[model samples]
Target: MIQMPLQDMIKKITDGAGISEQEVNDKIKQKLEQLSGLISKEGAAHIISNELGVKLIPETTGRLEIKNILMGMRDVEVVGKVTHNFGIREFKTDNREGKVANIIIADETGSIRIVCWGDQADKTSDLNPGDIVKISSGYVRSNQERNEIHMNDRSVLEKNPEGITIDIGPSAASRKKIEELAENEGNAELLGTIVQVFDPKFFEVCPECNKRAKPTESGAYSCPQHGDVTPNYSYLLTAYLDDGTGNIQAVFFRNLVESLLGKNAEEILSYKDNPSAIEQIKTDLLGNMIKVTGRVNKNTMFERLEFVVQSVDPNPNPDDELKLLEKEKQSVEAQAVTEEVQ
Candidate 1:
């Protein structure tokens, strides 16, 4: 039921297939008339694009701002700087193999993750942090509570195209109180005190596939992808964060947890059986003011909003914050004095 604009669909068809705009328009009109209300205009455009071997960019031109992207939108275009690029990783299934890469792209409005699949993943190999790129014919989908743009075979990747200039800079993450957090608001930054640190635990993962390993009756762990194999350890940390307005549960994965704890998974795993060591670690994290950045999503398991922490800053400077608070307090007192004088 997703619909793209008619003009965008036409442009995609012509540009992708190297056909004239008139030719694509004629074919689209023919398809619409032949279908005779059986399909919508966007649907007919898709059909025409498929028949002509044109990769239709979803419903938008590449000029749409990052903040305006939404779920279920097709052929969305965006231009932004690459803030973080996780190099390509390969995977295999029973029948085939493929590669995928993920990079965080940011504009002045905000940031979103771009997932490039198959050969398109290779196309992004030369991209580095601070490189401005344009994504064309990409599709939008909501992963958890994050808006993600995915590039398929038909998607276009343009690096620093002429005549287009984006002022490259760090994407600003909006500061939100715990109570103000909403699902699918893109990326967010929150400042809160860690009210509680749940017990940290390590989960066994498949060495080959990196998915959680399943325990078998034979006292060995099995991975669905690679069968029986020696498992690797991955950390999962859960905690509650509270600002004055409200409290929310936050989850951190291996890398973020390592950064916050100042230790790697192996070092923490060494103390797994030592209850006192684990308790000491948890105690250290409690009552600390930290800033966390990540996507907010509905945790189906808990049936509530949960934050998936991507990055954490344990020691952000508070001088500016204190000055701002002082300025606000002084303004309030000045207003009260003015009222008394009146």
Candidate 2:
């Protein structure tokens, strides 16, 4: 069974059924009343999708394009040219240890993050830039708001696969002002100043799988797959970024967290034991200019929109900023003139 976020499910339904989001919500509410609130909103939406003849998952036998792959899809297959290799990271848990490899691949449509785990990660070492790879039996997972094709134990990885060629292109992210960002918009680039920064929050996860672990009946935390284990710690950092147009809430995960703070993983994770250690870092980030590319997600729990950053550049080119400034100025002047003519 495919488990996707409720908002994402609603998005697919509204797009497929040619209906407004409000109409879909009204129907879901009606369904809840009819069923005495027995079923979940997601289940109601799924039923509505089926009744409208809107298929949530595409039915096909061939490989999919990167753009067509959605979060929560399973048994996915895609072939693309490897654009970059991020190298492999190894982690250990009480029960087992494994490696994770992150690679960026692109097709004519767009690029995506392919995360290989365990044995599949080893295969990535043989891959190089411009090499073609075919991924089979992969699962699509949403990290923050971006969809990544994850290959686990049941997945297949083929390097320099025959009969495969992809016309790779530059990243498809749209460079937009903070004010111009829209919910569900993926691969967006924002150049802005750090208006505000929050103290980092640390959390525990299963080291082997890197999923959230919870307390068991006993005192120790346990992973559903890894059983009772010593958990590894990770941190989350959030800040408000402002370009001249507006400000947006931006979130940075583990990999980019170190880059943002100019600290190594150990130094950042050390804050878990001493919570007060991050005050200096938090103070340093304020008022700094940075460039970020990420996906904008409607933060349902917080009831606001947020940018889940995938990449960060602490020092961006000033010339590029000047060009954008001029472009924005012209756009504003053109808009004012059009308004006057109207």
Candidate 3:
């Protein structure tokens, strides 16, 4: 039996497979150590990644698969167009006394914060808010609040000269057939990366029907469709979402606004600098799997289909569904009591 160092075993495993070195050294240390006892010293020295079936990827690494990227991974390169730039922040490192720049980048898959060091930050300057980028050799890292990617010395990025490509994965937009969506009664799974969120403005429209709001003489707005009604100005986000099947504009109604910001739609739309609000809205919708229940509105001018959302539930979070069930139960019980009284 040959003797092998644990470090060597980690290297061998990560090198053969697309797994990250951090996975063998940090996350799977205990598992590797335990497996070490079972194998001969020589065998342990050459732990194969294929033995694990799947690679241990880092968090926030952009990849070909948006779902996998959102969930976190070892390393991945994703291509996306920057929908908005929220500026960059500088943070100082205690040990090195050096600063790093942090910026958020979004693809049709989702949005993740990228940390740039030294020349990388400067190189990214040419990449503006709407330009496309191919982030290469990126690794995922999770913080206390969320998962993000580090674009430090180890990472590399390239601009996409061919324009932003529209290929998400199998679970992404291509699967949502418009014909099927029209026939389905309940929620339809929709895939898209949100590109924009329009800020709300003062307008009058029918409360029931969201037609173009009209202005009247009393320094107020009125909806002509609904006669003699008070004007309501609500913050509703208008997002450009690309689902590969086609790029369409969508209105994420009210609940999605509350779920994302812990605030109502009215609050989100009223902000003066709407770019920040747009960023938050994008984070909540992009890359995240969603089941959008709404009717399709065909845009004659844009030749695109829009989902005027009735309800949106993040597929990754099951608690929202559970809450809906609980509410339904309470409603049914209350209705039963009312019927008995009648």
Candidate 4:
């Protein structure tokens, strides 16, 4: 990671704040010495930048490819095409409710998910599939076995910006059957019929980080990352899906649930308080065929194989697949008859 020179950073801060260069340098030196063994020179420079209200982006480092990104990197720039965009969901903290959006962007090298929070989430409302974008000053972190980029207040999001063109290769997901699903199979597409829609459950989430908020002994909700949150509601749906050969439990989050039930979390939560409304939603979804794309994992809590659905297509055509199966079955029956006669 390239860093701005101390002299150049000091000059910028002094000029921007109408302060003497000597005073700025002394302040930076004092901060560095105070935390002598704790932070590096680059970290000290970052502290100085924040203190002086200066945003730092290395001019010489250039844009990083998605393949080169590592966890804990900051102020990185990358350009890619939006391959998948998820619905914005709301969460509440002690202060108020906030929204978050997530999307998967891909370049020729690979793909990574970008999480946008608060007003930044609204900025992604106009983004569409295949749209080129440039993200600047973004933060990178790894979560749930995958690396993701986060756009915060300090980040910049540009759509179809000049001097950037990413070759977004095929984004189609590989199809797998329920019987063939293995633990940690990454992302895959599956076709199956919903055997049952279990009663949906709602949980409280922290508004700041969008993590689940656990209840405290004092009758308040708290998040590990963001303490003392007011708690916002989010829905989770578990259903059994069968693809002829086998069956597996599938879990659906807010976006997938809305897509499948045609209702958002708020609407779903309203129904949760009414038994008839909840049953109606179950009645409308059970026994329906769907094409699901998601990550396969082992549910350690339940000791069963589970699919965490990313998206759901409630209207999938299974006629062609059934025809092929019938044709193969007929061929096998004819061979069996010939063998019996012989």
Candidate 5:
């Protein structure tokens, strides 16, 4: 039920009417002139959309795609492949004690996160990456400025729905500054200088399943599924990155830490027992400019935003970065206007 984005409306008009985007813009400009600037640019676009017989409202299409699942929608059904399973998270508040399951699903159009609650949350127990999923009777809500589908006890989730298949490519990361981040982003790129780097904390993961291994009563760690066995080590490195406008705490996992510090995994593990061994490396990292693209995770326990680094680029081309950021700025502005009218 949310208002369609102004750019989306313009695209609809241009594509549906088989006219150039410039022509659509020219038409909107004429409409604004006729109205003597009484209406906003977005209003003019919507008027032009209607004049060109382009419908801005979402209709009940068969098997709705994630990208078309607009905000403020209810009782919606969608089918997509499970791209990621965030597992279950339990929360206890003053009067409520419950858990929610989160998973990201993708179709050819796009991807989105779905939050499952109550009995519906149990349905995610067996979900894995690359599994087709069908969700019915769900509602979409805005969380941290992004759209997410919510499933309550009334919703139904079908795992591996028959004859349903989805072909999706990789999702693109949005480029923005640290101050522009608000945890709504799925993946974001930030170019900043490392102001500080902390010692990495290493842990054990089951070699077979890659699940975290918990310490046994005897002190040796073991995975829940694989019993007592040798485990591979993983680590997370934390650093503060400043992009002039603001700064953010960024965390890089074991795989990306090597590139982040220009060191190998074995070299990083050597410092696990001797924390001071990394001081020189840490000092070298400070003031070094790098770019990171990753998920924006809110560390509930720490009560702060942390960027989970997925990819690292020690150097980026300035001219290309400026062009991308400018395009992103326009997209952000149009989304802001859409939210306003909604």
Candidate 6:
């Protein structure tokens, strides 16, 4: 007989309703199989934690007591005040329909939005905003914005009413520097703050557009529906240093955003399906502190230096860049000192 966690049981019940005891058992079996697929490593870790009587909480939910949580995990216990809850509602789409809830929770670490489902929705409703609660088995899922964590039914909630404890960590990752990162090729890590920003403009078409836009008599440009055309410019710049044999500065352009945030780019391109959207994004990329991991190659169109950014932090902030820059400065100074001593 498998002793399933209450949170897991709640997920099984909420995911599929109006079930019988035998069905629940079957669901448990299926859940175990599914869990094996989704959480083999985490399950093993949980088993060991259980044997050791260790508690785990999601990184965003708890106080500083349980700060060592790993990344990309589920099932953490946290104690926090219920800042708010938005009840439940139907979320309809061409593909499917379901329910979702929004709640605000906070501990010493910080605050974030949490979403509840099914029974978890009801459980959330019972508690008034500002009431402190001790939540067990609360799992973290990315919010609709894909930027932060939200909770769901696979999690458990209890009204603490008193004070609750939670764990905390750095709200974001630190980024490197450009001067330090301008070395060689290979997998590089860099972090820097955005020191500059450029404006965005509109575009019509180039010779590249086989159909859409056409050239104007004034040597400007024009499109079919978009009319006498101008390109849209948007820039997003961040600083990063690649930690290869030596540090190397890295930068990303429109192509990198197309790779990392294609969905958003697609939305902008929906009306025209032209190069204007990409140009807009690039123009808007200035003064945005960024950490990029990619290669350093000479800009064929420019000078002896250029950075081809690969992946970047979609959600970056000021403090993260400051800390990373400080660390890199220290490392560089240390290396310089050593060379002088030698």
Q: Pick the candidate with the highest TM-score.
A: 5
**Which residue pairs show backbone clashes in model 3?**
57-73, 57-74, 58-73, 58-74, 59-140, 109-287, 204-213
52-135 per-residue lDDT for model 6 (tens digits): 343443226542222232234456665666656657876788997777676666666555556676666666767776677766
lDDT (Cα, 0-100) at 119 in candidate 3: 66
Error of 5 at 109 (Å): 3.8
Per-residue lDDT over 1-342 for candidate 5, one digit per residue giving the tens place of the 0 to 100 score: 365577887888888889998999899999999999999878898888778888776567446878788778888799988878888888899999899999988888877899998777888989998999998989989876678999987888999978887887666887788998875356798899999888898899999988899888898889999999788888999999999999999999887998887889888898988999889988988998898999788788987888989899977777887897798889989999999997
TM-score of 4: 0.46
Q: Which prediction has the highest lDDT against the true structure? A: 2
After best superposition, candidate 4 residue 11: deviation in angstroms?
69
Which of the two candidates, 3 or 4, achieves a greater TM-score against the reference? 4
- Over 1-342, each residue of candidate 4 has an lDDT whose tens digit, in order, gives 434456676777777767887787777778889997587666676687778777654243558888767667788798999877775878898998999998778888878889998888988888997898888999887775567889999999899998777776555777787888865555788888898888888889999888999999999999998899998888889999998989998999988888888886678888667757788779877789888998777675777789999989888667866886688789989999999997
Question: Is candidate 3 or 6 superior in lDDT?
Answer: 3
Candidate 5: regions farther than 4 A off: 1-63, 172-174, 180-187, 207-210, 230-233, 315-342
- Candidates 3 and 5 compared by lDDT, better number: 5
Clashes in candidate 1: how many?
Answer: 5
Q: How much is the lDDT of residue 39 in candidate 3?
A: 61
Ranking by TM-score: 5, 2, 1, 4, 3, 6
Give Cα distance to truth, residue 230, candidate 6, Å: 32
Which residue pairs in model 5 clash with each other?
none
Return whichever of 1 and 5 wins on lDDT.
Answer: 5
Compared with the true structure, all predictions reach lDDT values of 0.83, 0.87, 0.56, 0.81, 0.86, 0.51
Give the lDDT ranking, best first. Answer: 2, 5, 1, 4, 3, 6
All models, RMSD in angstroms? 12.6, 12.0, 17.9, 19.0, 7.2, 17.1
Estimate the TM-score of every prediction. Answer: 0.48, 0.53, 0.33, 0.46, 0.71, 0.29
